[model samples]
Target: MPKVIFHKHGQVFEDEVKPETNLVVRAGIKQFPYPNLRYECGMGKCSKCACKVLAGAEHLPPPNWKEKKQLGERIDQGFRLACQIWLTHDIELCQEEITA
Candidate 1:
């Protein structure tokens, strides 16, 4: 299992998930990080699931084309699409609150 630390709206959410877990999929199923992990389009087309990796970034693979297309230069800043990440190691990340 991998421990996930998710920060959003000044709150911290922590959970242990199975290896290779996708945050968006977990959220969609109303698991940990749900209601905090803002996401749409689990296919990685939407940037709504974007989050900044605060720790354990080295464990993640290089960003894929969708992340490169969606996040652009922000990738250099450690931002990644949760939908596109399959967690196999502990990770800490933050998602800024989106205002309507």
Candidate 2:
């Protein structure tokens, strides 16, 4: 199992998740972090489930074609469509980030 560290709404949650677990599905669970994540399409088209990777980004598999198109240039900045990604290893994710 891989550990997923989630940061959202000033809350931090760490859980051991099975390999290849769909993040969108996990987000839908009340016990998971970011319980309010929206998914209109349940596919990559909505792009509403995007999250920011703040650490251990290398642990995730490369973005697929759908993520590539939806994320566009944000992909290069560690943004990923959670609906299109699966947790493979330890990762620190934030639902929102404030940059100055």
Candidate 3:
């Protein structure tokens, strides 16, 4: 069980994320910010799921080809495809820092 903290609207939401959880899906379920805007394409086509990795990158799976292609060189930065992430440790998300 890993904790996922979401900082949004001047409020902090902390929850434990189960294995194989999709960030976008979880955000949508938790209604973080504008869930609709956060999760547009279930597939990797849409960049809606993209977000800045505040922490836990070491605990997250490496970006797949799709994510790499979508993120381009930004992948080298903190940007990551939230929908493709499978939590291995605690992670934090912030709407203000979202890249896509």
Candidate 4:
């Protein structure tokens, strides 16, 4: 299992998830990060699930086409589309809250 540390709105959420887990998919199923990990479309089209990788980035594979197209230069800043990443190692992420 991989440990996920999610930060948002100055709050932190930690959980252990199975390998090859997609945060967006887990959230959609009302899992640990649900109601906290803000997301819309499960696909990579929506950048709503974009988050900054604060740790364990080396364990993640290079961003896929969807992430590259959606995140662009932001990828260099460690921002990744949560929907595009499947976790296999511990990861720390921070998501900026969207204000209406």
Local accuracy of candidate 3 as per-residue lDDT tens digits, 49-93 = 777777777877788988998989978987787777777778887
lDDT against the true structure, each candidate: 0.94, 0.78, 0.71, 0.94
Which scores better on lDDT, 2 or 3?
A: 2
Give the per-residue lDDT of model 4 (tens digit) for 1-100.
8999999989999999999999999999999799899889989998999999999999999999999999999999999999989999999999987669
Better of 2 and 4 by lDDT: 4
**What ranges in model 1 sit over 4 Å off?**
none
Q: Clashing pairs in model 2?
A: none
lDDT of model 3, residue 62: 80
TM-score of each: 0.96, 0.81, 0.76, 0.95
Global local distance difference test of model 4:
0.94
Least well predicted 10-residue stretch by lDDT in candidate 3:
30-39
Better of 1 and 2 by TM-score: 1
Model 4 steric clash pairs: none
The residue pairs in collision within model 3 are none
TM-score of 1: 0.96
lDDT of 3: 0.71
